[model samples]
Target: MSVTISFNNVIKKYNDKPVISGLSLDIKKGEFFTLLGPSGCGKTTLLRMVAGFNSIEGGEITFDDKVMNRITPQHRNIGMVFQNYAIFPNLSVKNNVAFGLKNRKIPKDEIERRVDHILDVVQISQFKNSMPENLSGGQQQRIALARAIVMEPNVLLMDEPLSNLDAKLRVDMREAIKLIQHEVGITTVYVTHDQEEAMAVSDRIAVMNSGVIQQVGTPREIYQRPANIFVSNFIGRTNIVERSLKKVDNRQVLIMDENYQIDLDDITQYAEEIIKVSIRPEEFTISDTSEGMAGVIQHNVFLGINVHYTVQLSNGENVEVTEESTLGEPLEPGTEVKLLVNKEKINLFHYESEKNILEGDSYAK
Candidate 1:
C-alpha cells in the first residue's frame, strides 16, 4: 500500500559536519514528490535518509504513522532505482525484473505472473527474453523500474535515475517513468538535479540549496512566483534587476529604469525604497515604441519555435528575452528596441533578504 512520508526536524552529519539540518517535510501517499537542486545540496542525502541507507543523527522519519529512524533498509520494503540500471548484466529482461521476487522465494507461478504484468506496465514485455547486454539503456532502466514496482513496496525512491541517459532518451524515459508511477499509484520520492525533469514529473517539488529547502510548490507556483532570488534564477532564465521605488504624486512607482516606471498598486504605500525584481525572459514585451524601457538588441539566436534576444538596457545590463518565431527574419544585432514588463507577472523582492516581498507585502507588516 502507498504510505505518506514525513520528516520532522531531520538532521544528518558527516565527520561532525552537518549536511542537512532541521529539515521537515510531509510527502502524501501516492504522490510524486521530487527533491531538486544542484550538486552537493543534500537532496540525495535526504532521499537516502528516507530509504534508510543513511543514518539520521537527529529528528524522525516516518512512514504513515510508523517511525522509521531505526528501521533497516531491507525491513522498510522500499523500492529504489538508481542512476545505474542495477540490473544483473547476465540476466534477460524478464529475469532481471523477477530477481527480487525470486529472492523473496515467491512461488514460481506468482513470480512469472507478476513479472509478466510489470514488464507490460513498463512497456518492456516485448523485450522479455532479450538479454540486458542487447537492450538499449532506456530498456534496461525500464527493467529496473519494473523490478522496483513489482514488489509493491510502500515507497519508491529514484536517485538521479536518468542522469546517465542521453538528452533525448532522458526526456523519453522521464515521461515513461511518470506514466508508470501513475499506473502503480505508489508513493514516490524522486531525487534529481535536473530542474526540467523535476518540473515535468513531480506533483510537488522541494527545491533545495545548501542543505535547505528553498521552496516547496508546484512547478507553476515555483516558476511563476519563486520564494527567492535563488529559486527564480535556478528554475529558469530571468533578468533580476535592482530598481528604486518612490512615491510619485501620492503613488508608489517602481522605476524599471530612468525611461520606464510601473505603478505599484495596493501595497505601494508600504514598499521599500529599493526593490529587487525578477523578470522572466517571457515577462518582457518587446516593442518599437519609445515610451517603454530603452534597450538595444545585441544579438539573437533562433531556436525554431522561439527566438532568444539579448538586449542591453540603457543602464548597461544585458537581459535575455524570448519571443515566438515568425516567417519574418529575426532582427539583426544593433537594433534599437523598447521593452515593457508584465507588472502582474513580475516578482518583487526585498533588497536585504532577497526574499519575494510579493509573497506578503513586507511594508504592510
Candidate 2:
C-alpha cells in the first residue's frame, strides 16, 4: 500500500539555529521525489523528521491524512536506506535481509519466502549466503535496499544512499533504484547533493537552500525556467552579463551592454530595474565576425564531446560558450572571436534578487 506524505509549515532547530523553517510540501503517492541542495541545507533534517528520527518543532506531518507527529519509528510503517549500507557484518546476506521479520516474530516459513523474493528482486539471490564484507559496494547497497523494502513499508526514505559508491557504481545503482521503485510503486523521498542524480531519477525535484524551498518542479522545468536568480545559478551553468534597459516603445525595451544592444518585449510585472541578462552556455554561437560583442579567447577546454571556450569581452568580462567539437578546428587562446547570443533563449533576472525580469513567463512557455 502506497501513502501520500504532506508537511505543513514544518520547522526544525538545532542549538537555537533554524535548520528547516516553515517548510510545506505535498508528495504524491507512488511518486519518486528528490530533495536536492548543497550541504547543510536541511534536506537530511527534513528526511529524518519524516522517518521519526527527529522531532518537528512547528506545524505537522501527515501520511494518508493521519497526523504522524507522535508516531514512533518502528510504528511509522516506513523503510529507510542510509549511506553506509548498515548491514550486520557477522550475518550472511540472507540473514541480514530477514532480520526485521525475525524481530517481528514472523513465521519462519513466511520470513524465508519474503527474504527469497526480495533477494531476487534486488538481483542478489546468488550472493544470499555471502557475508556483507565479501560483497562489492554496489552489491552491499542492493542488500541494504532488499532488507528495507522486504518490510513492505508504505513509504521509503533514502538519505544519500549512493554517496559511498564509486562514480560508475553510483550511476548504475541510481538506475536500479528507479527501476525497483517503479516495479513496487512505492512512495519514495530521496535526499542527495548531486544535481545530476536528482535530474536523472526524480519525477520532480525540490531545490532547497538555507532552510527554504527555492523551487519545486519537474527536472526540465527547473532547468529551463528557474524561479529566481539562486535557482538559475544553482541548477546549471549560465553566463550572467550586466545590462541596462532603455525604453524603446510601449511594449519593447532595448537592453544595452558594453558592445551589444538587443530588444526585449513583455516586461515582468515585478521588473522595475534591469540588472543582468542570463544566457546558457549552449545558447551562443562562435563566429569570426562580431554580431555586436567582440572578445578574445582566454581558455579552451576540450571535454571530449563538447568544447568549452572562455572568452574575454572587450569590456574585460568573461563569457563561456560551448560548441560542438565537429564545428571547426579547436579555438586557441588569444584568438579573437565574435559570439552571437540567442535572443529567444535569453533570460533576464533582477540584480541579486528573487524578482525575475521575465516574471514567471520564463517557465510558463
Error of 2 at 155 (Å): 1.2
Residue pairs with clashing backbones, model 1: none
In candidate 1, residue 359 scores what lDDT?
A: 42
**Top-scoring candidate (TM-score):** 1
Please provide, for model 2 over 275-347, each residue's C-alpha lDDT reduced to its tens digit, 9 standing for 90 to 100. 7777889988886565657888999998888999998988898988999998877899999888877766677
lDDT, candidate 1, at 241 = 90
TM-scores, all candidates, are 0.96, 0.93
**What RMSD value applies to candidate 1?**
2.6
Estimate every model's Cα lDDT from 0 to 1: 0.91, 0.87
Worst 10 residues of 2 by lDDT: 265-274
Q: TM-score of predicted model 1?
A: 0.96
Model 2 TM-score (2 dp): 0.93
Q: Give candidate 2 regions above 4 Å deviation.
A: 254-259, 265-272, 359-365
- Compose the digit string of candidate 1's lDDT tens values, residues 1-365: 89999999999999999999999999999999999999999999999999999999999999999999999999999999999978898888888888889999999999999999998899988999999998899998999999999999999999999999999999999999999999999999999989999999999999999999999999888888899999999998899999988888888788888778898764544444887889989888897677788989999999999899999999899999998887368889999999998887888888899988764432222
